[model samples]
Target: MNLATNVRIVLVEPAGALNVGAIARVMKNMGLYQLVLVNPQCDPLGEEARRMAVHGGEVLEGATRFENLPEALEGCQRAIATTARDRHVPLTLETPKQVLPWCLEGSPTALIFGPEYRGLSNQELNYAQRFLGIPSNPEYPSLNLAQAVAVCVYELYQLSQNNLAVPPQTTEAARLEDIEGYYQHLESTLLKIGYLQPHTATARMAKFRRLYNRASLSHDEVALLRGILRQVEWAIKPQAGDAE
Candidate 1:
């Protein structure tokens, strides 16, 4: 299988048909095909989008749609979300060149972009394992949605052509969906144990996410961790024989 096909370009709540069409055209130009739209604000197949797509119409037509970011990234092992916002907790923001290569290492990966106007919120950003911030002039740092797609697509295309030095995969990384399940299991357990208060759970979970993302846990690795959590829950539960 062409590893290039493993990379998905996911647009979250994109607003402009023209921009979506243009993004399709650029993906075709760079030999990338997977385009995923999450709750798009405009019809990707509308006239405006079609008009901009020109010869790249097929890419636009073949685009898949999802209700949310997590669904769009269901099978992905790694994901990077694009954002210009600064977080209070401070996630390390790397340029596209620095982080984009991580996706090309053979497992399914996603490059996420937020809406045109407001960008991604912290909650939405939580779904990604990494964050991308394209370098631009401080005077006007924002890039048009299509322009941003083009820049990232070009970088990926160049790396793919150069045969980026990716080590052969020996173990499968935990799919984002599985990792998310573990996170949920972990959070619930933590709450039951009084380790996490309701108001503080979200913030504390973000730190856990960062820690796990950095570890790049494999499928079995995550399973083992979750197994431990389940055992902990079992051990802590009140025995029926002991209840007064």
Candidate 2:
């Protein structure tokens, strides 16, 4: 399979039409066709954007716009997000060379990027399985949104085109929407069992997401886990009244 073809370049809350246009162009140049925009703050198809997209105007016009990251990533099986700065928690930040290859293991994957001014939020970053950070001069670490996308796309193009040895993908991975459903079910089940308090459920679930995402759960694996969660929920269902 042409791995690059399966990769989606997801831009979250992009604020500049020029940036979006440039991103569309670079994606085309790198042979990546999927572009998903999440809650774009600027007009993606303005005159300026068209000028910047140049030969890639079609990519810009054909890009899918989503209301949020989850909506954008619905059908994607694996995703890696770009963060300019390291978070307070110890999230593993890999270089594109290392992480891009792993991304090809899953079908309909994504390489997520945040808006230009401020990078991905903690909440947004949680949606991704892994994180990536490009090495740059520490004195001036920030990279333009489009530039960052370009760099990663270039790396992906080289990796997919060079016929390099890639890890075998035995099973088709489960989609993010399915994984997210499982996560919701798990959280509700855990809360029902008093394993998680309402106030702290978010924090605890983030840990669960990280752990399970690392496993790269296949379709059957996710189904088995969801079934287990469902059984737990059924067992906890009150004989009198049940809360949604």
Candidate 3:
């Protein structure tokens, strides 16, 4: 099965050249191509990476670089961040087989992996609508970065072979940027209404983000929500000639 070209493999702050190189090779093996690096700590195209990549030199060389996760995820409609660590946020950690298939259902999807030492921080994980955790022995559950990427990529490749059907969409799915915009607007409006305070906004917003993400909000849905926030802002504004 031919993998979807829109599926991007994003490595966040990856520090190991060998791991990056091996990830490139496996992506090629699984018929995946797109690779995005976010502020990589190591040289992706250096000799060490090239040596490990072997025949996948093109994939490594052709990788796109971004300064941050949000920028890396621009234009993507669906994203699933892989991690072993848990956070205070209320997010379900699904296995790869369950969530990897979601990437094929949308264009410009992302499978995000965090740095080598620590997994994605809560802030980094927020960029994705879903989270994936590969099942392993409880005693030793963490997998190498390349191994995790390979496992997810292989599942994607296998799913493609079976001719997985894209689920019917009732409405156009919201792009990450669109959702991000809504978040900004929502925060602004909430602050104006005293629903969120400057000191606690970040914590409160994380819960709201999880709520909206779980909804898998469509473009129209986000637009409607933003419109409501706009109206709320307008309602609270002091009109001309109003009492001081």
Candidate 4:
């Protein structure tokens, strides 16, 4: 569970010094150090943040500031945005428990937190490939910014510590290339059978892609799907007599 260096915590327009400091302390406790601030409203080095940071002062001082969320996440390949409220934006929301595996998959990842008062805007959330929703009492579902980070980071830490043996990295998950090919085959097959209209094809395909992507289908699964598409295509095409 050597995740100490793989994750960057990004705070967007944090207004409370105490929360920033507290988050630094938690980050230190969890053995994580990379912190990025986007348009912070308070001096991250102010007394309140430092006081809470205490032994984690180094993490706070070394934190980088950014003008916006995208700048902070420039080189990051994977990002998970935390939100308590539901939005109509098309995103695959997963619980922290479900997202931990992907976060621990040895890639440079970022965990984004939005403004203290409003949380992440819909536009800001779009930068993330996935959304994480922490399970809290529905009666009072809101979580403090620092607290949300603590929960997500801790779950990640625990998953790392468990160290379950994963399949070999050589057996990579299905790539976007293969996924796209499969999508093309599927849509063409569906259209041939009059299941998808030309006018609605794009929107329907987008939703299907999201569903397939969330499963994180492996190479074998993708192959199996492609085979199914081939069979359907062969069966549906007009034969010589049928066409006449």
Candidate 5:
């Protein structure tokens, strides 16, 4: 399978030449390309990186560089940011196994890995629609950036090969944009109905967003719920002193 076309591997400020090269080799073994680097602290074409890449040097050479994360993700519709620590962000999160399918869902997607020393910053992670964390020994759970990328990419490669029961290939599969819109609509409706107070709405909405993202609601379902929210808004507007 041509997994390269579906997903891009993004390295943010990666400082280690060896790790970058290792990642390139692993990506080639897994049949993936499309590498992107954001403000790399080390020269990607440096001797160490190229030495480690060996046969995969082509991937390293063809890599695209960006000064910022958003520029690297311009054509990507879905993005998953890998983190070792939980920041309690508003975005939904999943394990590698849980997120691989969505990553392969026919649109340009990216899996972001942060710097070698510290993982992604909360601000950097904000650009992603979701977070993915690898399950590890809690005693010392943090994974090296290149290792984390290798694991996730390998898992995705394995999933692509299995001729398992595939979900219906319909346009209704709730996309990231659809889910985001629904969350907005739901939160607004809840606020209007006094169920979610302005002060506590953020926390409440986070839980609901997690639920809906896990469920992966269909487009029809999203439309139905949004329509209900619209109706509620319309009904409340008149009572709030709006004529007509």
Candidate 6:
């Protein structure tokens, strides 16, 4: 039903040309097109990549490159990133079947995969509102980059092509930048009010990010929160002299 057009697959710091090429091929097979590479270590158009891409050469050649994850995700309203390992902090890692449908609910959505050696770092993972991990044999749990792409794309393509009931987006989801702005404003306002100490702010803010992400706040909700932060700043500025 032409649903795959809005989906984007992002590869972070991919270093293997073959993996890049194969990923392109699989994406095309699954009727998915958009591909973004963040600080890739290999040329996606190289011979090895092209050889692997074969029929999907167009996808590989058309892939966009970015210096960082946030840059790669600029316009995405919904995103799910993959991580192989567990985190020290609390996070729900869903199976592909469980999270793939979320990709269809928003315009310009994203599914991110980390490099071959290591999956996404905690900082990089924070950018994504959701996280996924494919269930595999625990004794040899890791999957190669191309394989991971293939698996997720296949499942997503099926969900997209079939008229499966993905819950209609009731409210326009806030863009990534909008959510990020709220986080920044929230942090600064909290610090100004002595509610967030500098030493513990990063960790505390992460928990907040996770909380709000799960809420999947709409654009208006984000605006309302930001307005609260602004008013708080205005109310507290007069008491600035008391802090010292």
The candidates, ranked best first by TM-score, are 1, 3, 6, 2, 5, 4
Q: For residues 159-208, write the lDDT of model 6, one tens digit per residue.
A: 87775648768788899888988999999989999999999999999999
Report the C-alpha lDDT of model 4 over 139-178, residue by residue, as the tens digit: 9999999999999878877877887424335454654456
Please report how far candidate 6 places residue 195 from its true position, in Å. Answer: 1.5
My TM-score estimates for the predictions, one after another, are: 0.97, 0.94, 0.96, 0.70, 0.71, 0.94
On residues 116-234, what C-alpha lDDT tens digit does candidate 3 reach at each position? 99989998987888999999999998899999999999889888888674774757899999999999999888898899999999998988988899999998999899889988988
**Tens digit per residue, CA lDDT, model 1, 80-158:** 9898877675788999889988877888999999999998889988888888999999999999999999999998888
Error of 1 at 149 (Å): 0.7
State the lDDT of candidate 5 residue by residue for 97-162, as single tens digits.
887777766766789999988889976775566789899999999887778989998898888888
Better TM-score candidate (1, 2): 1
Q: RMSD in angstroms, all models?
A: 1.2, 2.6, 1.3, 7.2, 4.8, 2.1
The TM-score measured for candidate 1 stands at 0.97
lDDT for model 3: 0.89
Q: Which window of 10 residues has the lowest lDDT sum in candidate 2?
A: 235-244
Who wins the lDDT comparison?
1
Model 6, residue 222: what's the lDDT?
Answer: 98
Q: Judge candidate 6 at residue 225 and give its lDDT.
A: 96
In terms of TM-score, how similar is model 3 to the real structure? 0.96
Clash pairs of candidate 6?
none
Per candidate, the number of residue pairs that clash is 0, 0, 0, 0, 0, 0
TM-score-better candidate, 1 vs 4: 1
lDDT of each: 0.91, 0.87, 0.89, 0.82, 0.82, 0.88
lDDT of 2 by residue, 1-244 (tens): 4754688899999999999989888988988878899999999999988999999998988899999999999888888999977677558889999888876654788889998888999889889999999999999999999999999999988887785537768887889999888888898889889999999998888888889978989999999998888888778777666565
